[model samples]
Target chain A: MIPNLIFILVFLFASVLFYFKVRTIAHDINLGKPVEIRDNRLMRWMHMLKVAIGQSKMISRPVAATMHIFVYVGFIIVNIEMLEILVDGVSGSHRFFSFLGGLYPVLISAFEVFGIAVVTGCIIFLSRRNIIRLKRFWSSEMTLWPRSDANIILITEILLMSAILTMNATDGILQARSNQHYPVVGSFLLSGFLQPLFSGLPDSTLIFIERFCWWFHITGVLAFLNYIPYSKHFHVFLSFPNVYYSKLEPQGKIAHMPSITKEIKVMLSGNIDYNAEGSAGEIGQFGSKDCRDFTWKVLMDSYTCTECGRCTSSCPANITGKKLSPRKVVMDMRDRLEYLGRNIRKHGKEFKDDKSLLDLVTSEELWACTTCNACAIECPVNIDPVAMIIEMRRYLVMEKAAAPAELNAIFSNIENNGAPWQFSNEDRLLWADNLEIKTN
Target chain B: MDRKKIEIPVMADLFARGKKPEFLFWVGCAGAFDDRYKKVVKAFTKILVHLDVSFAVLGKEESCTGDPARRAGNEMLYQMQALRNIEIFNAYEVKKIITICPHCYNIFRNEYPDLGGKYEVVSYVQLLNAKLEEGKLKLSSELFSGISVTYHDPCYLGRANNIFDEPRLILNSLTGNFVEMRRNRRFALCCGAGGAQMFKEAEKGDKEVFIERTEDALRTGAKIIATACPFCMTMLTDGIKYKNREEEIKNWDIAELIAQSLDL
Candidate 1:
């Protein structure tokens, strides 16, 4: 009863902490304007199911997908065992679902199998990062902290899996000894291999090991739950909703500025009517200057980034060794959001700062994008770094008139010559000017 | 000035005569102006006439489709330009459009609809593929059997619009020796000319994007590089020139290849 009371208190404390962290993230996201991504509910659900739930896009790279699917599936399936653990924790019972007789062992054994898969997947990923050193992991934006964050998560999973197997192994030996507490649960397929090693231990020591493993596993899970909100692993939760809310248009379409369109139309119509139907949203600024200026979907995209560098790797500019990396752009945006969140916490939502997102994302990086949609297509979770890049470009071009000189010339040419060059529209048929061709 | 000129019907003139063509040929900014891409326009128009497909050019009545302006982040200019072009289209009651440049095709099909300009837009490759499948057009294929050709997937046509099969179908039917680069379809690399990069010099990088893409094309061991987009044509042509592969490798628009192979 005492242990059960302690378990309840710990669980409550962890739950409260996790709730507060999630609330802060939601608050940060709410600081931005709403994006109209709610259209086509059926299509959105289909996309979400295919990309996030089914992990279909992850399979584009089969080797990584194989390892990732194992880890992803294991993370979810093993957590089912959490239900039994929670029941046992609160009720002061051993294998609380053991009353199911034949079915109970099968479930526990399946979880043990998943735990083993998780360890194998994590080890493979760890080696890829640490030993084999995949180039994506070592990219510029993956600084010491980000690198350590990934390694820590992988190591934590492996350690957690080991603890589960150890706990099961010790419990099996205790049950063999016919202890009063350790029930004769069915043999766990993976963890049963460790039982012979602990067979020589006395009943009292086995009981201590079993109780210690139980507490450790429960505490570890609670800590991991809180840690997710702070780590890149937040994608594990956000990828589902992010994919659901992803852009469904043809990939070529840069979102048209409806507000700008209204302004242009009003000017074009020569102001015949003093009042016109302008855009519903405020056309106060041309483009994004800060996190709050970005759409909520863009903010959510930054948060959903796994920092996997798939977007960066496939980027044409990045491939040619340009300064722009899509992964870095996303990470910087997320960092900026965290900074804003902290500022709002400290000095309230009205807090102002001189630093803008532009301070981190340079104009050169913005200009380097070919707008080829490679980065968007390559992202497993559908995080569109291009949206932020183009949004910032709008800010530079419209707000400050700070576009590159050549682009300025091109714009003016299109405005006057009806082309992107200095050629005359009267000579538009220059291609056919000196050629004989059959015509209808 | 020794070359002879031929008459191409302008939409305004046709409209004045109370005639409407089945399709509007959107001779984009590049098609009308860029010398290299001008040939692409002629070649494609040649095929349209060869198939006796009724099409009319807007000629001087046409203007920028606001693709470059939109991509360069000048939304006001893009909207103004787009609004003007839409007025012309509406005036002529254009029902269908055939766009040779993928950038123009993308903007016309995907973006112009948001600004109340909607029409059935087809890329030239899609039209060619349709004609090929419908048996309206035929290529002997024997004329280019020994000439190894590889296709460079224009990003706007491929990844942007998911148009990987149409161009391949056209090329496969035309060239019996067609091969794919290592990165094809959704994974194709961009020519250095997108996002207003054609007008401006490249940003600081270890190498030019076109040079890297040219290296990919060279690796395929195909002598003829077939392109669909006008911008891709210019960039790849420059890439071939820069690598001094001009004497060995030729970058031709897919329309030119079809026109040549069909003995037109």
Candidate 2:
């Protein structure tokens, strides 16, 4: 009874701590400006179902897709068994669901099968990342912690699955011996094979092993739940909502500010005196300088990136040896947002950080993008990294006047000649002058 | 050689004579200034006249649609150019527009609507396909017999605007046998002229993007490298020269192929 009370209090404390951590993340993302992706309700739901739940985009690369699906299904389906574990912990009983009679053994056997699969999948993924050194996983952005965080998730999952299997095997042996509080049951196929190893153990030691395994499994799960927000593994929770609110417009269409459009309308109406007043007051700044200048969806996109490096692998600029890695752009945004979140939490609402997202992602990286939409297309979670890059580039040119020399010349040419060339409007018809076609 | 007579009316001239034509032919910056692209402009104009499409040119009144400016992050300059063109277009009450350049087609069709300059715009490839569907233009299938051609998709027309089928439809109507590069349609590589990269030298790289894309075209062994956008024409032409295969493979715009096939 005392142990059960301790278990309940610990579980409650973990849940409360996890809730506050998630709330803090929500607050950080809410700092971004408003964007209207709220419409198209049915389409958004369909997109989530297709991309996230169905894993439609994952299959583009067959090997990774197959291996990932095993881990995915195992993680999701095995959570049903987790509920029984939770109940057993709270009630201080062993094999609490064994009351279901025939159904209980079937469920345990299925859990054993999935547990083996999960371990297999995790091992393969860890080996691929650490041993094989796949080019996608070894990009410049995958520095020490990012690399280790992935390994940690995989290793923790393996240990958790192993603990569950060991607990079931030892408990099965003890039940067969008619030990106190151990109910006899049919063999769980995979766990039953391991029963021979614990056959000679005394009852007290066997009970202790079962109890240790149960505690380890539940505590590991709680720890993993808390660690997710600080890890790139946050995609496990964010990918669903991220894919749901994805942009439906044609890929090349940049977001035009209606506020800017209204200002342009007044400027073109010939009522505003440009030379006398010198400028339109409301015309204001054009693009994003910091995280707050970005749209809320863009903030969500940064959180959704899996750091899988698929975008960087497909990027033309990255492939051509440019310093622009699309994956790095997303990681930098998240790092800056985390920095600002930490600042506000420590120093109250009035705190200002001297650093900005520009310090994280450089001007060289911003200028290297071709705006090809390849990164956005390749992202499994539909994260639009190029959209964020374009917004930053907008800030560079509009506010800082930091465009390259050739672009500045083109801008001047367009301002004066109404074209990207040096030719005047009077010379526009010169191409057709000597042609034999009839002209009026 | 006797030049075929064709009638091209300026938008201002038609508006002064109390005449509003069916469409405004947007002669983009390349069609107006680039020397080699001028021939492509003439070929497209010849096809439009032969089909009896009532189109008028903005001529000196037409300014650049400022696609390069918007792409280069010059929002202020882009807006100024867009607003100036919008004012001219609304003054004449222009309703429909056609252009042979994909950059102009994309800007007019996609970008202009956001700037309050809404007009029905179509590229020459789309226009030619629509004319054929409407029975307004006819093709002589025997015009170019036994010629193998591979079509290169311009990034703006194919991926950006989703006009993949229109170009293929026009290609199918010609007499030449059509083949595809390994990467075609949505997965097609860019010709490296987009996003104002054509204005400056390519950033330091192992190989130029166009050269990479051209190598894919050459592997197909097509005699003619077909293009729709002048930018693709120039890039692929340069790519062929770089590979020293200019004598073996020639870049032909889709409009030039259509005009020749129609015997216009």
Candidate 3:
């Protein structure tokens, strides 16, 4: 009864804290303008299932993807055990789901297997980040916080998995001793292998170990849940929604500005409305200067980046030693959005932070992009860094008129000659002037 | 000045008689103005005429498709140009378009619909593949029987549109000797001309994208580089020139290869 009471109080505290943190994140993402991505429900759901739930794009690097899928699947399947643990915690019932006589062994064994797999996956990933020292994890964007954040998540997961297996191990031994209220639950296939270590412990010591593991596992889960909102690990939850709302148009198409389209329509109709009040959401600037200027989907995309650096590794500009790192583009946007989120929490919704995304993402990085979409293709979670780069580039070019000189020259040519070249429209026929072929 | 000139029918000339051709041969800015790509326009036109496919040119009525403008973030200019072109296309009631340039093909096929301009658009490679499949065109295997040719995938046409097989199928059916670069089809490298980079010099980099892509092409050990997009043509051509492989390596549009290998 005492254990149950303590469990309830701690769980309530963690729940309340987690609720407010999630609310803060949602409020911050909502600061951006609404976008129409909710259409095509069936298609969106299928995309989410394939890209996020299935981890379809992760296998571009076969070995890393295979290891990641084990942890990803383990993370999901182990949560069923988490549900049973929560029930046991609340009711003070040991082995709460032990009623399924035949299935109980199978379920506990599967949980043990998954727990071991999670530990193994976490260890391999931790070594890759620290020991092997893969260049991707050490890219310029991954400073101390990101580096430590990745390590912290891995270390925390290893500890949580250890607690779960240890709990199962100690519980199995206690059940054999005919302890009161300790039912003879089925053997945990993987954790049973560890029973020898607790073979001869006293009843009071065994009980202490079991209770400690139980508390540690539950508290660790809650802490991990709250930690997700602050780290790139947030993608574990956001990837599904992000993939669902991915831009469904042909990959080559860039959406034209609707406000500009309306203005052009008004101009074509020869209606003189220069003095009239602009329409709602008049779009004061031509493109994104800050996170708010971007669409809600883009803001969501900023939060979904996994910082795996696959996007950066596949980038042509990065390969060619250009200033652009698509991964950095997403990370910088996420950092700025986090800043805005914090400011709004401290102040109010209308809080103005003089800082902009441009300060974090340079014009050099923006211009260096070839808009190749390789980064988008390589991203395991469907985060589109190129789209954000282009959006910011749109701001740099349209608002500041700060396009590179060659682009400025081409823009003038397009205005004057109706082409990117300096030649006139009459010269458009020059190539065909001496060709002997039927045109009509 | 000592070259033979051909008579081309303008859309206005045909529209005055209340006539509409089956396809508007969209001679894009590059195909119309770039000297190197003029041969591609001529070659594709010859193939269309050889197959007796009814097509007409907009001639002077056609302007830039504003692809570079749109990519360069001059959305206003892109919209204006797109709107004007749509008016002309709608006025002529154009039903279909074929172009040798992927930039025009991409903008016309993917983007124009958003601006209230919608029409069936196909690149010359797709049309050639269709023509070959339909038996409207035939190739003489003897033309390129012994010549080794490798096809470079234009990013806009291949990756952007999933058009890998059409050009390859045509090249394989025409040249019996067609090889692939290490990075071909969806994974193909950009020729560095995309995103309006063609109109501007490349940003500061260790090496040009085209030069690296050219190195990929050279690794394939093929003498003839068959490309579909004029932008790739220019970039790869410059790459070959940069490497001083002009005497050994050459770039030809797929249409030119098909036209050369035709039974006609």
Report chain A TM-scores, every model. Answer: 0.96, 0.94, 0.95
Q: DockQ for all models, in order? A: 0.60, 0.45, 0.51
Please report the TM-score between candidate 2 and the true structure: 0.91
lDDT of 1 by residue, A385-414 (tens): 888888898899999999999999999998
Candidate that scores best on TM-score: 1
TM-score of chain B of each: 0.97, 0.96, 0.96
Judge candidate 3 at residue A49 and give its lDDT: 87
lDDT of residue B107 for candidate 1: 95
For residues A271-296, could you state the per-residue lDDT of candidate 2 as single tens digits?
A: 67644443455556788888878888
lDDT of 3 at A170: 89
Best by lDDT: 1
For residues A1-440, write the lDDT of model 3, one tens digit per residue: 98799889988998999899888778778878787776899998988889899888887788789779878888889989888888888997878889989799899899778888889899999999999999889878889999999999999999999998898888889888888857887677888888999988997888899889988999999989989999989998889888998977766778668877877777777775666665424547887899998888888988998799998887778878788899898888888888998998888888996679999898888888777677887788877786787777778888899999999998898888888888888877776665664333
The 10 consecutive residues of candidate 2 chain B with the worst lDDT sum are B1-10
- Residue A213, model 3: Cα distance from true site in angstroms: 1.9
| Tens digits of lDDT, candidate 3, B44-102 | 87777678788899888888898887877778788899999999999999989988788
Clashing pairs in 3: none
Q: Is candidate 2 or 3 superior in DockQ?
A: 3
Error of 1 at B1 (Å): 24
Query: Model 3, residue A66: displacement in angstroms?
Result: 1.2
